[model samples]
Target: MSGLRQEIGQKAQAEGFSTPRFARLAHDLEQQARLRAFIAEGRHGDMAWMAETEERRGSPLSLWPEAKSAIVLAHSYGQEFDPLERLQDKQSGVIASYALNRDYHLLVKGKLKRLGQWLSHRAKTKVKVFLDTAPVMEKPLAQKAGLGWQGKHTNLVSRELGSWFFIGTIFTTAEIEPDAPEQDHCGSCRACLDICPTAAFPAPYQLDARRCISYLTIEHEGHIAPEFRVAMGNRIYGCDDCLAVCPWNKFAAAASDARLLARDALTSPPLSQLLELDDAAFRALFTASPVKRSGRNRFLRNVLIAAGNSGDTALVPKVTALLSDPSPLVRAMAVWALSRLTAKPEFAALRNDLMNSEADMDVRREWETA
Candidate 1:
């Protein structure tokens, strides 16, 4: 152990990162293979960026050959309320626990930058920090650093902290003894697999991003597949069905960062009000939040899908108003919503009103089916 390592660990603990560990920059060939198979199978779906940076993602050495060690940090953003509590209200959409407040990338990056400066000052080494934005495979790196094992759900999980945390990485040209990776304790429990609304897990320890609602509403930019809409229920934002079902979360701590606490309006907002938000209002509501990254059109597209699944005829008028939205993707989803809302009689009237006049071919086809 080096004097620099001990000093940095004390500083990190004082800075609020729950646990910090150091790991040498070595590629885990097995995890890299799994990530390759995942992307090659097209499980990443429309998230092309995952494939674009394969080299850096597979090995930290490729990201920066001079990097001698990777410092992995974990921050628990646990919930005060049972996140599942919001799901019972069918009329109110459930936003994922992690996204209920401010974006983790921004929050964690700011802290990691401070940590990096501390490293440079103490060890006199060049350092680089990363959140989720970078190509580095953060979860695998964290596990290698003894932060925790990647749970069967493929998110890093710990016996002490469970799965309610975000992982950050700091790469530097400093030698630090690595910790042994933690063993997986997921065992025979399949709570996360059975709980998915879209059957996104082809098997345990894997995810088909196409069927994951988090991908559908966030990474996916176009109209959501019709068959999955009903299964989506009222989750207008990212889904947390898998994470909420994990029994390990019982050990998770309440978030100490005030910025991560769920805003009351977002906890279980009415589907109608969410659908009614215009672009300007949506920007105002989610300005610094992760939800804002999806942009208004993509979010409204999700809200329309939720409206269609809502089984509330009252929302049909609101959905109808978005048929002429500037984005064709939003317009197409509005057509799907109208189709789901109205029966044969009203459907016929809406079809006549929209079919031929719709400029988008996809919207026209959706209206024809409606």
Candidate 2:
């Protein structure tokens, strides 16, 4: 069993995974309690899916009763440049490092499936694979597999790879020797917690997703509260302030996978050009990228918020053009952007003119409050 595990690890590394480890399928009592607490507090925001599948997500055994061992895999997608520095360019959007390239779900899952087939053939046993889309609690499973310990920011931080890797899992009926779990190494360090723009971390290991900029920009559905808008700055898709500040990144290496490398166009996309995207243009621009999942309206809504926080008068006309946008969500955010960019008197005049004609109640409310 130990020799087989060694062979699997070598194969996984060659397939582009950082390292792979085996973990016995057992109920993680501590993680289950933490997840229950998180759900009870409504910390997941609009992500009701977490509550819907809590039981299955709580343990690998519940997900697949036949599974006896989990092969946890990690793939490093470490940033080549400082993700935080892009925030200084207010005219451009600061997309998260992970989403700056092809969607990792597609990339990682392909590799995992191929590896699963090889493992099943070798052991003559059944196997199943999963990426982030699955209900599995991958972070906890990764910790149990000795991939890394969960950092103070509540993200997996590796001594070798920092917090800049994607995790995938393979569940199988074959028994394998489990690796020793990693222990917490974060000592007297609060860089990740202190640097959060929205203070999403309520405690050392607890996160309030409601106030998280990444949640607000990506998973969130409607109008972002006024308080978080300014703090959001130019991040249109996701925020990386907390992750980039982790000191352990000094030992990290740049992503070697060509498919995971950051695309130049998405690195620092111009807010002005993004504002002009209609549905067709938006779909074409983000095809195969995770940003497309947000849909045209929701993505544009984020762009409008970034434009509002930009304080650039040049974006006023671009924002004003969306006042009559087909989607109420886009129109509402456009109203907020216009109010921020235009002088009070000019904004009032424009609002008065547009208010009577606006049919969407939410969009009208934005103008009324402006």
Candidate 3:
């Protein structure tokens, strides 16, 4: 079993994955209870899918009845520099490091499929692959597989790889030896908790996704809540403040995968230029990138919030032009941006002129409120 684990690890490294670990296909009773509790408390916010697929997500056994063992893989996407440093540049939009390149779903899934095939051939057994796209509760499974422990931020953090990595899973019917699960090493450290701009962590190891900027800019649709908008700063795509402050990251290596490298354009995009993106321009710029999943409307909505928080009057013109954007979500955020950049009297004048013709209830309300 030990020799088999070493062989699998070597194979994973040669195939471009960080390392592979194995976990038995048993019910994770504690994880199941925590997940059910999270749904009951509504901490998942608008991610109702967590509740919808609770049974399947609760255990690897339930997700795949034939699965006897789970192989977990990690791929490092560590940033060469601190991602949080961009917050000082209000004129720039801060995209999460992960989204700054090609989507990991494509890259990680490809690796997982290849590895699964190799393992199937070697062990002469059926195997299945999964990435973030599946409801597999990857974090807990990764911990169970001895890859890493879940840090206080509710993200997998490794002593060797830190928190900047993507997870991939391969479930096989072949009975494989399982590694001992990792224990929490966070101790008294609260770096991830204190670094959060939105105080999204209710307690260590628990997150309120509702207040999380990543959820707001990505999964969340429509107008962002007023309280979170300003705290969002210029983080237009996703937030990484918590991940950046983890002390364990000092030992991490730079991302080896060229496909996961941050594109220069997305590293710190100019808010002024981002605000100008129409649907077609947005699609072109973000094609194959994770940001495209937000769509032009939601993406622009996030950019407008950043513009409003930018405190740069120079962006007033660009934001004003979006007052009549086809997407009501964009127009509403544009009103908020204009309100921040324009004087009350001027903003009132613009709102009065725009309100009469606006039929969207949400946009009209933004005008009335602004």
Candidate with top TM-score is: 2
Question: What is the Cα-based lDDT of residue 217 in candidate 3?
Answer: 95
Give the higher-lDDT candidate: 1 or 3: 3
Model 2 worst lDDT run, 10 consecutive residues: 252-261
Candidate 2: Cα lDDT at 343: 97
Each model's lDDT comes to 0.85, 0.91, 0.90
lDDT of 2 by residue, 301-370 (tens): 9999889989899998889889889999999999999989999999999987989999989888988886
Clashes of each: 0, 0, 0
Query: Model 3 RMSD to the real structure?
Result: 1.1
Query: How do these models rank on lDDT, best leading?
Result: 2, 3, 1
TM-score each candidate: 0.96, 0.98, 0.98
Extract clashing residue pairs from model 2: none
Q: Which candidate, 1 or 2, would have the higher lDDT against the true structure?
A: 2
**Error of model 2, residue 51, in angstroms:** 0.5
TM-score: the better of candidates 1 and 3 = 3
Which stretches of model 3 miss by more than 4 angstroms?
none
lDDT of 3 by residue, 106-213 (tens): 887887888888888988889999988788999999999899999999999998888899999999998998989998889999999998999999999999999999
